[model samples]
Target: MNKKTGTAREAPFDLAAEFEGARLAARLFGGESAGSYLVAGRLIRFDRLPVGDLGLLTVGFRITDRPREKWTRRFNQFKYGQPSAVRAATRTLCAAFGMFRLDGDPRVVVVSSVPSGQNVVRNDTPASKLASALAGSRGWEWLPHHVTKDRHPSLTGIASAADRDATVDGKYLAAPIGGEPGLVIVVDDFCTRGATFTDIARAIRESNPGWEIQPVSLAKTERAAYWKGELTNAHIPDYLDAAWRGDPAVASPFF
Candidate 1:
């Protein structure tokens, strides 16, 4: 505890969580669990431990390898804000972190949002339900926070970087979280370039310093770039660590 501030300091990495989280991610990606997920096309998985200031970010669903193909109708269903689609994606995300054990009464920070193109949009996306489910999970005391909102236009997964940033800039709309800095999980339904997650993380960091933040997205669309070298098990953790630290060798394929 900080004697003066009387708040807990940032907890060190739960190397076990990193090891296990990476293992689970690799397993899911290596296998056919993520239907229509092509390893060749995806770059960042947010499976590694939080690097310096950025937390781990993982998308629940992956964009299909082909433009016409899909993991299922769920992507379309999700765009329509269908509950079943949200639940399925939530389960996938929860499954990924189901075994991740952490310390303290970590708060679940949810960023509920909708696509601008949708005829109908609901604020309570998978993030709300995921937080609820996570509260009962991992045998940890999970506190739910007042939800954040994007209430903005969702991307078509085809926007240029400048355009995407412009559309998403200052849209994070910071919500002050009052508590001792500990652990916070930021959840979103879909991420492209993770602009929302990045913005949200910045807000939380500014308001709640020393808190370990992890961002989880239900789905993400990214450009394709396959790893030419072998990403063997023996080197997963080290490679990820290096990647997070800006190592081109690992970042080339995984980040």
Candidate 2:
């Protein structure tokens, strides 16, 4: 268990067992199978990260109305220029990094999050600030102003797969600026459909195909929340429904 966040550590054995069980259940009951697969050649973790994918991952689940609501509110405060929220997020990230065991002296690079809209400047998002803080704490390199949202294909209100795909395709990624490639960690406060990470991965792969891009968010929505509120055999789905209550089309699928 992670002492700082009071969340259980993602053990390799447990993950493997869970995956095996999921596969077995799928074979027996005709449900969605489980395993680390790729969307645009990037491994996606709807529920949990695979072993060795990334250490000291999420702080908590971001399911709507869950205990993570407080964290989400704090993150929004930081986004809207709250100093205390920034400090809190920084401290939490630092603590999480301490818990993860790094191998050798891996060259860590933090990706700057894209702005919300075309008029907004890059490196101004709250997630970027969190990444900057984490990079500064470990003396790791921080790449800012590297990516930006080219269009305002607002994925906020829409809940259809077609709309989500269109929004994701609208995102633009600038070529990496740093010298050599290393482990690229993209930080975000919340992940609903993972379209942001997917777009970022596609951009990175286009430029530096060999670099490993790991998407680390503070919280992620539960897979079961995407379905009809029934979680008897909950498993992460390829496309998730926008389960947030604030969403105009909460019942719509995110991606």
Candidate 3:
């Protein structure tokens, strides 16, 4: 500790936060191998990271009034600036990542883009907050990029499936890539048709082709909630085969 220079120190990892995350994961997936739900979440595969791809891992299901409903409620609070939910939420997203890190790479970079009027560094959105919390704990580092100048229409209701591709394309323009390449994870609160992941991944991949880009989400819609009421968690297990809440999107990514 440099007393004269007044260097700041990162907060120690909170055991309470870890407990909360484990509790949430257990409640959502189950007590036995809740991390089993963490799959190779490739509803659509962007690329591979290592021989063991980090893949597209996700946890839990999130559609209004469906499985993991309670989680969605907290997620909404997390979205709307609930400061308390950040750490817990982050750990849940990465509840069992140690399972992978033990064998795969431990270095992780979680990135996200925001709506207009927010820059990456100053952004305090839920995803950003979670990323910051994770960075403080593990070797994860938060790269505040993905600067979108325009606020596009949110893909919800009918727009989620109908105009998702049109809405998300070309919106996530990230800054020039610099620094060493680690596992780059582009995160979202929820995913449906993979359009959001595709668009965001497309932008990041273009900027840094060699860097492995992986998409992680807290929840993946079983189907377009607005278009149809049917949502299934079945497709998730097939792709990840070793994942949680069925993170892999077995269906075709494009509509």
Clashing pairs in 2: none
lDDT of 3: 0.51
**What's the CA error at residue 220 for candidate 2, in Å?**
1.4
TM-score for candidate 1, residues paired by index: 0.56
Which prediction has more favorable lDDT, 1 or 2? Answer: 2
Instruction: Give the Å shift of residue 131 in candidate 1.
Output: 3.6
Clashes of each: 2, 0, 11
Q: After superposing candidate 1, which stretches have Cα over 4 Å from the reference?
A: 1-55, 59-61, 65-76, 103-123, 138-151, 223-255
lDDT scores of the candidates, listed in order: 0.47, 0.53, 0.51
Best by TM-score: 2
Local lDDT at 206 for model 3: 78
- 2 against 3, candidate with superior lDDT: 2
CA shift at 160, candidate 3, in angstroms? 5.5
Q: Kindly list the per-residue Cα lDDT of model 1 for residues 132-233, writing each as its tens digit.
A: 554444443433443344555656674577677667556554446676666666655555555656666666677677867666565565333432333222
Query: Worst lDDT window (10 residues) for model 2?
Result: 236-245
Residue 16 of model 3 has an lDDT of 29
